[model samples]
Target: MRTLCSSTLIGEALLIMFAGLVAMKLTDVGTGTIWAVSGVAILLCVLLCGAITRPGAVWVGWALQLGVLASGLVLPTMYAFGVVFGALWWCSVHYGRKIDEFKAQRAAAEQAAPAAA
Candidate 1:
């Protein structure tokens, strides 16, 4: 879960930066505002990497995703990017748990084999 979520967040951070640059170039939004928004999004991604094991971190991640989507108000392209990343986030959580489950099962089987031997 941590690995998957962290990887997804790293990707999201990059996308947010890209969107910020685009917004700065194409929109009337102030450079300072773009910088602040991008900075906060990137910072959240870093914090989320460490907080993956913490309670309610997933909710924070979802909020960040919504923030990314909201940026579409400034840069319409971000809506597509946000949706794509959101799906990726979902996949990361879903498949990551499945992988963890498989690993646990394998470990249990190994332990049971040795015990039976």
Candidate 2:
């Protein structure tokens, strides 16, 4: 879960930076406002990577997803980016959990096998 989630977040950070560049060119908002938002969001992504396994971290990721989606208001291109990354987030969480469970199950089975021998 950590690995998958972190990967998604790191990718998001890059996307957000790229979107910031687009916003700078295409929007009326001050460069400061654009970069500030982008900077905070990028920071959140990096920070979230470390805390991915912690309690409530996934919820924060969900909130960040929504925030990214909202970035569409600043630049329409972000709507597509937001959705794509959102799906990536969901897949990472979903499949990562399954992978973790499988690993645990395998470890238990292996342990039990030795005991049975």
Candidate 3:
């Protein structure tokens, strides 16, 4: 969970930076304002990486996804990006848990084999 989630978050941080750069060139929004919002969003992405193991962190990730979708009002392209990244986030959490469960079962099986021997 941690590994996949952290990777997704890092990807989001990079994408947010790219979006900020594009917004600066294409929109009337102030540079400081754009960067400030982008900075906070990217910061949250980074911070959430560390919190991925904690309770409610998944909800936070969903909120971030919605925020990205909302950004489409400012930059129309963001709606597509939002959906793509949201799917990635879902896969990370879903398959990551499956992987974790598999690892746990493997470990338990190994332990039981040793005991049986």
Candidate 4:
């Protein structure tokens, strides 16, 4: 589940960045800089999510995510989007732990069952 959550967060980040870029281009809002910056931020979130998710990288990922959220404030829409992304990050963190626990239990059960047989 942690892996799934990580993938989901990464997917969301990519989707948001792509959508924002496309919208800015189509609307000609002259906010190219905004979109570009957001895209980079989201990309960083993707990396952070992946990193922290792997046990030892948690602090780094958390810090980077916070930075991304803070930087998103320049645009209200981006800020909202950042909040959603942050939620994903939280879910990934918590869910990943639970998933790891379940996997460990399942592995233990499997090993025990074979021995019992």
Candidate 5:
């Protein structure tokens, strides 16, 4: 579970960094400052999702998704990416918990089997 969270953060950070580079290369307003800000946001996202164990990580992820959605107001072309990320965020929060529950139940059953033997 920890590895999953960390990998997710790393993957998102790489993707966001790539996007920032593309935006800078393609747009007239290629502000290095914007890319720097995004780097910080990506790092924070990594720390929040990977290092934190509380519900705060989930909330922060959702907020980032919302920020992605809001970006459409300024960059309509990127709306699809934001929508997909939001959907992924939703699934991660929803299904990830269910999987965790299943793992706990499986572990409990395994521990009980040895006692029964």
Candidate 6:
């Protein structure tokens, strides 16, 4: 779960950086605001990666997604990008949990087989 989620977050961080650059090129928004927003997004990404094992971290992850979506207020293009990344985040969490469950089941089965032998 941690591994998969972290991988998705790394992708998200890259996207945020790209969005920042694109916004710089396309929007009338000041460079300072763009930098601040991008910096916050990147910082949240780092926090998400580090806090994977901590309690309530999932909520923080969700908040970060909301922040991404909110960036659309500054750069309208971010609305589309935010939705795309939001779906990706959902997949990462949902499928990542499934993968973790499968690993646990496989480990349990292996242990049981050894015990039976």
Deviation from native of the Cα of residue 78 in model 6, angstroms = 0.9
Query: Where does model 3 exceed 4 Å of error?
Result: none
**Which lDDT tens digits does candidate 6 get at residues 1-117?**
798789878988998998899899899989899999799889899878988768888778888888889989978887887898888888888888899899999999999998999
Global fold similarity of model 3 (TM-score): 0.97
Per-residue lDDT tens digits of candidate 5, residues 1-117?
Answer: 444555566666776777777667766655776577677768777777655467577777777777766656545655887787777666666677788889999999999999999
Poorest 10 consecutive residues by lDDT, candidate 5: 1-10
Give lDDT tens digits, candidate 2, residues 1-117.
Answer: 999999999999999999999899999999999999999999999999999999999999999999999999989889898999999999999999999999999999999998999
Point out the higher-scoring one by lDDT: 1 or 3: 3
Global local distance difference test of model 1: 0.90
Query: Given candidate 1, what's the lDDT at residue 94?
Result: 87
Q: Estimate each model's TM-score.
A: 0.94, 0.97, 0.97, 0.64, 0.80, 0.91
RMSD of each: 1.1, 0.7, 0.7, 3.9, 2.2, 1.3
- Candidate 4, lDDT over the whole model: 0.65
lDDT of 2: 0.96
lDDT of 5: 0.70
Better model by lDDT: candidate 2 vs candidate 4:
2
Off by over 4 Å in 4: 19-53
